[model samples]
Each structure stands twice: as structure tokens, then as C-alpha cells.
Target chain A: MTTANAIRLRYALRRERFSLDVEAEIPDRGVTAVFGASGAGKTSLLRCIAGLERAEDAYLELDGTRLDDSASGLRLPAHRRAVAFVFQEPRLFNHLSVEANIRYGRQRRSDRSPAATFDELVEILGIEALLTRAPSGLSGGEAQRVAIARALMSAPRLVLMDEPLSALDAARRQEVLPFLERLHARLPVPLVYVSHQQDEVLRLADTLIALDSGRVFASGPLEALLARADVPGLSGAAAAAVLHGVAGSMDDEFGMTPVESRAGQLWVAGRHPNGTTLRLLVPARDVSVSLAPLSASSIQNSLAADIADVLPCSDDSAVLLKLDASGVVLFAHVTRRAVAQLDLRPGQTVFANVKSAAVRPVFAESPPGPA
Target chain B: MTDLGPLLLSLRLAATTMLILLVIATPLAWWLAETRSRLKPAVQAIVALPIVLPPTVLGFYFLVFLNPNAFAGRLWFEATGSTLTFSFAGLVVASLFYSLPFAVQPLQSAFETIGRKEYEAARTLGASPLDAFMSVVAPLCRHGFLGAAVLSFAHTLGEFGVVLMVGGNIPGETRTVSIAIYDHVESLDYAAAHQLSAILLVAAFAILLGVFALNRRRAAAAS
Candidate 1:
């Protein structure tokens, strides 16, 4: 009830070109991603919160402790603040070997004890083999992994990552994402990740703070905020709603994995062991709605749902129908003509039509939720 | 025979000048690289003055500035009881000024190469400002330090006009290898002049070669 460990930041920075002024509160557990396009002040916000950039009218508090408050003239220097940053570039000390880079923070940490043990961090990040190697020899993925481990070894209360995966190519990104998910599951410290990638947000973020031109566009639980239709230009044309589900069954013959959620069982083209928690992103444009189920349709997924709400699309030429499937929320983008034909209203039962191919598997965690 | 006095004096002066400049230029170059102050350009221009100013002009100003009657000269006289011109201490002051850009330019460029990201990364990892510089900035800029030290030492070794004006070609007191070579040449002692000049030439070439080799290795490793 006390909102202990919650992070609150309000800052205003004025410069010649871009000025960032934003206020946001994030839960101090799980990964809260600051999602935005480039030049959205994502990195600037992280720098300000880390105390690297001083801002006018700045107020930053973690839980109840004031880390920075311009009104009170209390500003904790970056070194004194228990925040670790994983930069976009690995930024490893080229002079130091991997083992030394990871230990650099630990050696200088104000608290002698670390929140995560060194062995555990190395094992989780899969960096044990790279321990003695110098940073110059590391591939992009390997260097980023070491950078993450190094940040964790410091035992910070918070970790701010500025597009840690942005610099890597696709294959390298795939290589590092699982380790990130593992870190997310294992570490209790809150992580604030700044990224322009939607897939990364859908996969990793528990809370999403969407930014637009240095201001908070919207901030809330990833599921609820991303589903809202009025947030124009959010994630571009591929914008979709995210749903959490548990893997129910896998059929080898069909090469499909059945994911059961409050919205009902949906088949996706993937294979995961039963009981693994999965995150699915169903694009709104991919979904179709009808008053009754299509019996002879090639489209695979059809679920009975009640109309939750109606909101205009960004251009107002269409309407986004919010569907409440059991307790889960799904969005369907339909033409005004379709809505007129269906006469969809709140409390009305309708079939939400979805193609199994459209149900993309975003991410999977072995043991879900913060540990 | 080596006649090792002028040679030793030259080595000692170069070594001492390099050491003092390292101490003085590290912070100044770091500040120049990192500060966003309005006066940054003005400060940078002043630091770069010696590179463009003719050695004779700098030497003339230094001669007047270090005269026992002037402010700095009077202070030096009071502190060390010796006139600034034609003394070993005066030679040191002149060398420091002459070789300053050599010491600072490489360091400033190196600090610039390291950039603010690493420093910020270090700070987030709970390193104080000084701690970050010592641990993160210093090691990362080792190449810069190498370049600066080698260049400063070589530049001091080859110095002629500034040392001549300030040190007054005094043997065993203020005379460096360059001055000694010049004295030998003026007196038509071609053997002595060639001996000292050869040493300077070989030493400068070897130092430069070492620097270039190290830089190439670094570049290759980076690639």
C-alpha cells in the first residue's frame, strides 16, 4: 500500500535542438520498458534518471527516497546512486579482459555485497567461457552479454538499459534475447529498458511507457495501454495487442503449439513444451469479427466474445472494436461499414475470427512473473 | 668518447619535462575534451598557441617574462634565488611551454575518442568521477598517453631556438644536446656536432617507429 520501491521521475531538460520534459512512475519490480521512436528522448530520460544529465525542475525518487529533487536542492551524484546502466554499445573497457570488466563495478560498488552472486550472474548470462578474453575479441552478442553481466554484478537497485540490443544484427539479437529474459526472471532489481523496437517491448516489458517527442504519450500495464486505439501511430502499422497464455499442448504432426488463455485456446506455429508461459501478439488488422462463427472457413481460430468498447482509429475512417474474451482483451480493426453491418454493441456476443498464422509467438518464459 | 654530459642533460631535461607535462596536461586536456563551457574555444586556442607561435617569439616573451625584474621572474628569483634566463630551471620552463601542444593534443584527442559514454557507464556502475577517470578513462587512453609522451620527449629533444634564447647556451648548466650541437657547429667542431645530431636523429626515428607500430597493432586488433 505504501508504493515502496516504486520509481517516480519528473524532469525538464532544455537544449538547442531537442528538449526532454517528462514525468513517469514505474513499479520497482519487473522490466518497465520506455518504448518510443528514435529521438523520443528515451536515452535522454535514462541519462537524466541516472544523474548523468542535470535537468531543471528535476524530481526523481525511488520508493520514498529522493535520489534527486531540484526543489529541495538534493541531487545525488551518479556514482552514489545505486543504478547500473547497460549502454547500447557494449562500452566495455578495451584495456580490461572480460572478467575484469565484470568485476570493475563490483570492486567500486558502495555496498560491498552484491544482490546477485557473481557465479550465478555469469552462469545466467552464459559468460563463464568468455571470462578471460579481452573485450576486443568479443562479437557483438558476446560483448552485450558481458555488458549485461557486468551491470548486474554491481548489485544495483535499478538497471537502465539504453537499447542494449539495437546495435546487434538480427541473428545476434536472437542470440542475446533469451539471456535477457533469463536475467529479467532472475533479478529482483527493477529494469528500465529504452528501446524503439516493438518486438522487444512485447517480449520483455511488464509495463510500457510510450514516449512521443520527449513527452509521455501513455504509460501503464503493457496489455492495457497497447490495446487502446486512440494512441495514434503507436508501433506503426504492425501495432498489435499482447496477451499472456500458458502452453497447453504441442502436436508434432501439425507442427503447431496450442496456447490457452482467457481468450480461449489459439494455435500458433511453434513448438514449446506444455506449461511454458507464452506471450502472443495478435495484430489488430489481422483480426475479423462476426456475429456468428464461420463453419466452412479456412481461418482457424474463432472465439466467442462480448463487445467491450468502441473507439475511433487514428484516421477516424475505421473503428477499433475491443473484444472481451472471457477475462482477456483482444482488438479487431474493422471498417465503419463493417461496424454498421454488424451493429456491434457492448454486451453483444460475437465471434472473434483470427488466423492461426496471425497469432505470432513473441516470447516465452520458463517460470513467469518476477522471482 | 660519449662526452655524456650534454647527452645526459638532454635526456634528463626531456624526462623531467615529460613527467611535469603529464601531470599538468592530463587534467587540462580532459577538461578541454569534456567541458561545454562558453570559454572552451578560447581556452583551446590558448593551449594551441605554442604550436603556431614561432619558437623565437615565444622565447623572447619568456625571456622578458622570466627576467628577474618581471612578475614571474621576480617570483622565481624569490622562490629559488636564481634568475630565470640562462639557468636549468629556466630551460625547464621553456621546454614545458614549447612541448605543451605535443603533450595535450594527443591526450585531448584520446579523451575525445573515449567519449562520455564510458564515463557515464562507469558512473552508473557506482564509480565516483575521479574513480571513473582513473579506472576507465586512463586505461582506455593508454595509446594517447603513449603518443603524447613519445612526441613530447622527441619534440623536447629536437628543441633549438627556445632553449637557445632561454638557456643562453651555457655549458653544463642550461645547454641541451640541441644547443650543444649548435655550439659545436658554430665553432666548426663538425665531429662533436655530428655525434650529438646522430644520437638525436636515431632516437627520434626509433620513438616514432615504436609509436606507429603500436598504433598499427591497436588498429589491427580493433578490426
Candidate 2:
């Protein structure tokens, strides 16, 4: 992307034990997930972008606006940056009611664009009933939703979320993830989401920036990066391919749904309405390779594929194989002994069996309507 | 019958001292709570000196510093044709010093308890530093402000040595309740002393009761 349509960041911070040095240009659209382990400078990077933590040698430009230039001694304060942040905790003002907390930023916003109306955000976050309640009375999920609404109401040019769902329990995370997905699809302002949870990234992010030891190990489109078997954390045990497809029809007798994608047709164990777009997450471990098509197998989904590349896993017992299934990429984890026995190589034809039960449908596109 | 002038003068002095201390202690307490500077301990020590140092010592310093010939006293004398020593204004100044810790300690602790996370959150939400403090910090710490005001007022009302050294015994201008009780006792009038003393004791108890009740309510709400 051109400089006018991207966020360029160059920061170098040195502390007693840990140091951060990163330089990247991220597209100013869609959800860009900053994925890394704990203490990988994820929160530090977000803080620097929000102007909360000033790096001595830093230059940050968002959509061509010079937010910070250490060389010229120009730095905008956090309030003036028009960059809103949602912390892991709700951090709502205890003195104000939920409605007041959400309106606090909207009233003080310097940009009077009226991008998202108060009623619309309240409805979108499902916080209309919580407007009059105090933040202290809300549950973890409810408070977080209010916090998200507060950030959006600020009319920020960019929004930064630092593990917005990390503090919650599993059920609360599930409760808030749908609202986040809705925001991902509907928000005009780009989001830089910091998370170590792979499932959240796979569900919400369009682009991914993986950080290792405070440096950018890889940065690209999410599909392309996750498809690479060579990247350490992106592959191996957490390896999964997110396939975009449209729902074809539901088999009422078998209780399954057929999804059509560029790769091929795959039957998932669910019922989805026809014509709705869906993303299916197929884990590599659930896929097994056979030399020829299995005539009488329990696995319902099978596709003919050419072996693209075989990569060694961290543990030597198994190997991760990259498969190109008609222009769509998929991964399969097969044992080293099986690879040796079958003598699998690139350019060889194989039938990949996928367990329909293991295929999870995530982030379905809502039917077009008032929302 | 005991004269009521000293009691009224004491109330006026305490009210004036509480108001002025709140204005002066707020920013100082906020700085003390938020700053990581090396000078923080030193500033805190100076603010707390009144609680540890004898009131006579502070009064002696005030007397020496605010006499007619001294710099501050000369400026006051030139401007208002009166010295800062042995006046109602002098008593007010002495009471402020006597009650400085009462005003600052509660406020500083309150600010520390609220922490910087909420303040930073407000800033990112497009509030300036001052705006964040007023909208977020002040309202959250309203009880702390009230506690400070009450403590300062009570502490100033009971002050004896500082007023005796700096303000002397000017009945309506500077003689407070404490001095009036002392005067009554020194003149062998036990009845007058007992009446004023009982009034001060009940007033102090009521003010403290109000503060403790407020604190209990806050704690209950928090829990």
C-alpha cells in the first residue's frame, strides 16, 4: 500500500531486561492481528502507537499524518492522537454510569464526523439495557462490550485493542467474540488487535503480524502466512487453514451442511442457511493422506490433491505436509514412518481425507438486513 | 457567662483554613501521588513536618518570618498597612500550617488508590490531562476530599500552641476556642472553661463520627 493508505512505524525502546525494535508498514484497513507470546512487546508496541509510551528513537505515521517524529521533536499527546485503546480490563470510570462512560469519549472527541451513532453502537454491542447501570454491576462480558462501545464512540482514526478478551473466562470470551466479529465486519476504522490466542486471530484477523523476541518475524495476509508450514508458531500443533466459502445446502437426513469454496466442496456437521458466506477452520491433525481414493471410509470429505511440500515438525515423530488442493492450500500432519512407507513426494497425486466432525465453522457472515 | 466570640472566631478560622488548604493541597497531593521523581520523598517530608514538629517551633518560625521587619511581613505591611503577625490573617496562616498534613495525606492516599490506569484510559478517550482529573479523579475521590476538609477543619479548631505564639490573645480577631478555655482556666473560672471545653469535645466527636460513617459507607459500597 502507498504511504497515504498505510501506518508506518519505526520504534526502538530499551529497558533493563527487555528491549523492543520493530519497523513495519501495516495497511490501514481491516483487522491486523499482532500475534506473539507474552512479553513479545505486543502491549509495548500498542502503547507506542497510542502515544502512551514514548520511544526515544521513534517515527510513527498513520495514514500520512505525522504523529511522532523524534528527529524533529514532534510528538502528539495521547489525547490528541485520535487513537483510541481498549485495555484487557474494562477500565471503565467508576464515577459514571455505563451510559456516561460510553459517552465520555464521544463528547470529547475532536473529530466531529459522527461516524457511528450512539444508538447504533449501543445496539450493535447489545448494551442498550446496560446504559443506565453502573459499570461495577455489569458482568465481565457486559463491561467489556461497554468498553468496546466507548472506544468506538471516540471517533478515532485507528483503534488499538490489547488482548481485549484475555481476562475473561472461556464462556465470557465466547460471549464477546461475536460482537468483536461484528465490529470487524462493520467498523470503518481499522483495528490493530494484540493477541496471543490463535483462535481469535483466525476468526477475526484479515492480516497478521507475528512477533518473535520484539521483532517482526513475518507480516503478510493471514491466509498466506498461516498456510506456510515453515513459520514456527503458526504451524505445528496450532496449524489450521481458514477457508472461505458459500453455503450450498443442508442435508436434513444426515444433519450436515455443504460448503463450496475454491478448493473443493466440504461437508461440515452443521446447518447453515443457503447463500450465506462461511469460514471453515480445518485443523491439519484431522487430515490424513492416502495413496488413492478410499472407497469405503468413514471420513465423509475427500479431495484429490498434489503434494506441495513436506516440512519437518519440531518433534521428529511426525511431519507436516503442505497440500495444494486445486489452488487452495491445506496442511496434513502425517507420521514420518508413514511418509517413508508411502514414499510421498512433491508432484504426486493423493487423496486427502478430512473428518467432517473436526471441521469447525467460524464467523459466519450475517444475512443482509438492518444490522 | 463565657463569651461566644472566641468560638465564632475559631469556626471562621477553621473554615477559612480548610478551604485554602484544599485548594493548595490538591495539586500538591496529586503530584505526590503520581510523580516518580526523586524529589517526591523530600516534598512529602516537608508536607508532613507539621504533624511531627512541635506547634511552638512552627509558630516561632512563623513569628520570626512574619514580623514587621521581615520580608513577607514588610510586603504585607506595605500593601495592607498591617503586619502578618498577631492578626486574624496570621492565625489563619498558622492554622493552615498546623493542618497541612491532615489535608494532604488523605488526598494523596486517595489519588494513589485510584491509580493511573483509569487516567490513561480517559486520555485515550480524548480527554486532556486536566479534564481527565476533573471528570474521573475528582468524582471518584469525592470522599477523600470530604475527609480532608473535615480533618483540616477539626485539626485547626483544636490548635492551641501555634495560635498562642503567633496570634496571641486578640479576642475577636485571633483568640480561638482553645485559647478562650485556657484563659478561663488561668483566671480560676472553672465553669466557663468547662462549658467551652464540652462544646469543643462534642463538636470534635460529631465531626469524627461523620468522617468514620462516610468511610464505612464507602467500604461497604466497594465490597
Candidate 3:
């Protein structure tokens, strides 16, 4: 990948018990989710990029600007790097009011013009009522929203969020996820979001960097990474595929929406507006393959798919089949007995049956209509 | 009536020492709170030495170091044409040493309580190190600063051995309240000594009460 419009990082950090050595060029637009387990050195990588943690052997260049280069002995301090970070906890200045906390970064920006005005940020985050309140007085979701606003007001070239919603409970995470989706759609700044939660990654990420034990297991577009069975956590029970398509129309009688992708049309259990772009998540376990289309089954969606690759599952009880419906990729987890009974192979053409209820519409571009 | 000149001098010495110590100890305390250097324990022990060492021992060293014959004293003598021992300037210096830990420990603990989280937050928000400390850290540590200042001032007010050792009973200059009370008792003036002793006793209690109240309120707010 070209380094001109990408964030190039090469860091080798060794701690007593954990070490992180990664070199990857991340795209400079959209949300790049660093998906990993708890100790996968995801936070360490973000810290190194932000200049909060110094690695002895490191070279980081963000959009053609040299932030760190161990060879030349040039390392910009954290404040000068202009890489805003939103930690898991709010970490707001307890002494400052919510408005003052948001302005803390704006007032310190070296650039005179801000990317988004204060009013626009407040509206985006829905934090106008929270402007004058103290940080201590706000709820967990509200504080995280304010933290996001604060990071964006700084006019940073890039933003790093280290599991900003992990500290909150399930309800609070739900509360904050929508605002994040909105920000992802509108903000011009690129974001490096670290999260172990697959649901969050599915909701917000366009690119995926899967880290395993302080190493880069895989890095690519989210759809491609999710389709690969070799990548950890994307197989067996956790296996799923994401499909991007435009909403065709809504069936008012059944309250179902038809989304059209290159793979084929799949009816989803929702009322998405016509012409809206949507991302549908199809779990591998939810799909079943047969030699011919089902004539009497209740499953509403069936597409002709060519078996691309059949790989063994980690549990040995089943096989994960990669299927290509037209050009889109999908996965089907079936038992070995069934795979043999149907004699499914790489070159065989089959019909893939999917329950419309199982095809979940994860994201939509247009603002959600009233309930 | 008991002479008030010594009382005024003692207040002046305490206030001057407290103000100067605030300026000097802030950075030292900040370094102690933030650094991960191997020499941190050694530096902490040195800062706390005055707390454990006998006041006279500290006073004796200060006197010797500031005497006209010593290197530091000789430099001062050459620069100002006046010796450092047995003067009000000498007493302020002695009290600063005597109250070093008082000013440092509170500020250090305060800085530690605030921790490096918010400071790093500020840094990432585009504030320089100094700017972060001023805008985020110093405000959060306001109570610590107040505690340090009050403790240093009150501790200096009650200092007797260090003052007597380095600054002799010079009436209008070096004779602080403690020395005045000591002089009264030595000269069989029990009534005069009682007056000075009671004032020191009440002032110490009030200062301590104020500190405890502030701590209680801070703890409540945090919870």
C-alpha cells in the first residue's frame, strides 16, 4: 500500500511478560478496528502510535509526516503529535466543566480553523444539554460522548479510541454505539478503534486488523477478513459474513426489506427505507446448502452459490465452507457427515438457503426513523 | 506585657519560608510523583531526612554550611558582604530546611492521587507538559497545595531547636516566638512564657483542624 495516504507503523516493544511487534499500513479513512483479545497488544499498538508509549525500535509516519523514527532519533512528544486519544474511561478533567473539557483541545490546536465547529460537534454528539454540567455529574454514556466530542474538537489528523465503550455496562454501550455510528459516517478524521467485541467491530469498522498474541494475524477490508476461516475468532461458532448492498424495497405486509448485493438479493427482517445502503450480517451457522433449491422450506432467501473452499473447523466436528454467490463471499458451517452426504466440493454448484430472520441488517446510512 | 516583636518576626519567618518552599518544592514533588527512575527511593529518603533527623543536627549542619569560613558562606559573604549565620535571612533558610518534608510530602501525595491519567489526557489533547500540569494537575491538586502551605507555615512557627542553634536570641531579628517563650522560662518569667505557649498551642490546633476539615470535604466530594 502507498504510504502517502496511509498510517505506516513499525514498532517492537518488549515488556517483562508481554511483547508487541507489529508493522502494518492502516488506511487513512473510515474506522479501522483493531480486533483482538484482552492481552493481544491492541492498546499497546495504539499507545505507541499516539506517542504515549515509547518503543526503542519504532518508525511511525502518518500521512507523510514523520511522527517517530528510531533511526534518525526523531520522536515527537505526545502533545506535538496531534493524535487525540479517547480512553476506555472518560478521563475528563474533573476540574473543568463539560464545555471547558471540550474546549481544552480546541483552544490548544495549532491550526486556526477547526474541522468542525463547536456547535456542529455538540449537535453530532447530542451533548448540548450537557455543556454546562460537570463531568462528574454526567452518566457513563454521556461522558463518553463528551470525550468523543473533545477529541474531535482538537482538529487531529487521526483519532485513537481504546475500547471507549468497554468500561460501560451493556445499556451504556448500547447508548453510545449509535452516536459512534453517526460520527463514523460524518467525521473526516480517520479513527483507529480497539475493541475485543465483534458486535462493535461489525457495527462501526470498515477495515479490520486482527491481532493475536501481540502479532498481526490478518489485516484487510472487514468483509475479506471475516470471510477467511484461518483467522482466529472468525470460524465455527463465531463465523459470520458481512454483505454491503442497497435497500431495494420494503414488504409492508411482512415488515421485511429486500437488500440487493452482488451475491444476490436477501430478504432481511426489517423495514429499511428504499435506496438506503445497508450492511447485512449473515452467520455461517444460519446458512445451509443443498443440491437443489428448497421447494417446501419456510426459508425465504435462496441463491445459487459455487462452493469456493471447504476448510476444517477448529473443533473437528464440522467443516466451514466458503461460498461465492456471484461475487460476494459467504460462509456455511456444516457437519462433516452432511458435507459427505451432499458430496460438497470446491467446484460444485449448489443452492444456499438462508432464513430471512437470521439475516440481520447491522447498519444503515440514513438516520433511523422513529420507532 | 510580653514583647510582640519576636512574635511578629516568627510570623514573618514562617510566611516567608512557606511561600519560598511552595515555589521550590512544587517541581521536586512533581518529579517525585511522576518519575520512574531508579534513584527515586534515594531521592525520597533525602527529602524526608529532616522529618526524622534531630532538629539540632539539621540546624548544626545549616550553621556550619552558612558560616563565614565555609564555601557557601564565603560565596555569600563575597557577594553580599554579610555572613549568613545569626541573621533573619539565616533563620528563613533554616526553617525552609526544617519544613522541607512538610511542603513536599503533601504535594507529592496530591500529585500521586491525580496520577498520570489526566495529564496524559491533556497532552494528547495538544497541551504541552507544562500546560497540562497547570490546567489539569495543579487545579486537581489545589487541596494538596493548601495542606502543604499550611503545614509548612505551622511547623515553622513552632520550631525552637533549629532556630536557637542557627539563629541565636537576637531580640528584633532572630528571636522567634519559641525562642521568646524559652527565654522567659529560663529567666524565671513563667507568666510571660505561658502567654506565648498558649498562643502557639491554639494556633497549631486551629491549623490542624482546618486541614482535617478540608480533607474530609475533599473525600466526601470524591465519593
Q: Against the true structure, whose TM-score is highest?
A: 2
Of the pair 1 and 3, which is ahead by DockQ? 3
TM-score of chain B of each: 0.97, 0.98, 0.97
lDDT of each residue in A19-75, candidate 3, tens digit only: 988888888888899988897677888898898998978998888999999999988
lDDT of 1 by residue, A1-371 (tens): 12666789899987777888788888888899898778766777788888988787799888688999999899999988888899999999888899999998998884657878889999999989999998989999999999999998997888899999999999999999988987777787889999888778877888888887778889888887876755535532445778778887799888889999888988888787898888888888888998889899987889898898877766467877788889788888888888888788878999999988888776565464442
Error of 3 at B170 (Å): 1.2
Candidate 2 chain B: worst-modelled 10 consecutive residues by lDDT = B1-10
**Per-residue lDDT of B32 in model 3:** 97
Best by DockQ: 3
Show where candidate 1 strays beyond 4 Å.
A110-112, A235-239, A249-257, A268-271, A294-300, A314-318, A335-346, A360-371
Put down candidate 2 lDDT per residue, B2-110, tens digits, no spaces: 4789999999999999999999999999999999999999999999999999989999999999888999889989999987899999888888888999999999999
Q: lDDT tens string, model 2, A303-360?
A: 8899999888887899888889998888898899999999999889898889999998
Per-candidate DockQ vs. reference: 0.85, 0.90, 0.92
DockQ of 3: 0.92
- Clash totals in order: 0, 0, 0
Error of 2 at A40 (Å): 2.1
Error of 3 at B126 (Å): 0.3
Ranking by lDDT: 3, 2, 1
Estimate, for each residue in B1-223, the C-alpha lDDT of model 1 and write its tens digit: 6548888888888999999999999999999999989999998888889889999999999999998999999999999998998898998999999999999999999999879878888888889999999989998899999988998888888888998888887778887888888888899999998888888888888888989999999899788
